[model samples]
Target: MAHKFPRISFFQRWSILFKCIFHYGMIFWYG
Candidate 1:
């Protein structure tokens, strides 16, 4: 359980990071 927590948080952070990068790229390209 404890070990899984780190993996889950890592994935969550990665997903948020990807989302931010994707949004920033879109705005830079289209806005």
Candidate 2:
């Protein structure tokens, strides 16, 4: 239970970061 917490948090943060990057990239490319 203790070890699983960090892994889940890391994945969540990574997903959020990736989404933001992708969004900006698309905006920059289209605009």
Each prediction's RMSD over C-alphas, in Å, is: 2.1, 2.3
Q: What is the TM-score of each predicted model, taking all chains together?
A: 0.79, 0.82
Whole-model lDDT values for every prediction: 0.94, 0.93
lDDT of 2 by residue, 1-31 (tens): 7566998988989999999999999999998
Quote the positional error of residue 27 for candidate 1 in Å.
0.1
Clashes of each: 0, 0
lDDT winner: 1
Could you give candidate 1's per-residue lDDT for residues 2-29 as a string of tens digits?
A: 6769989899899999999999999999
Count clashing residue pairs in model 1.
0
Model 1 TM-score is: 0.79
Model 2 clashing residue pairs (backbone): none
Residue ranges of candidate 2 with Cα displaced over 4 Å: 1-4
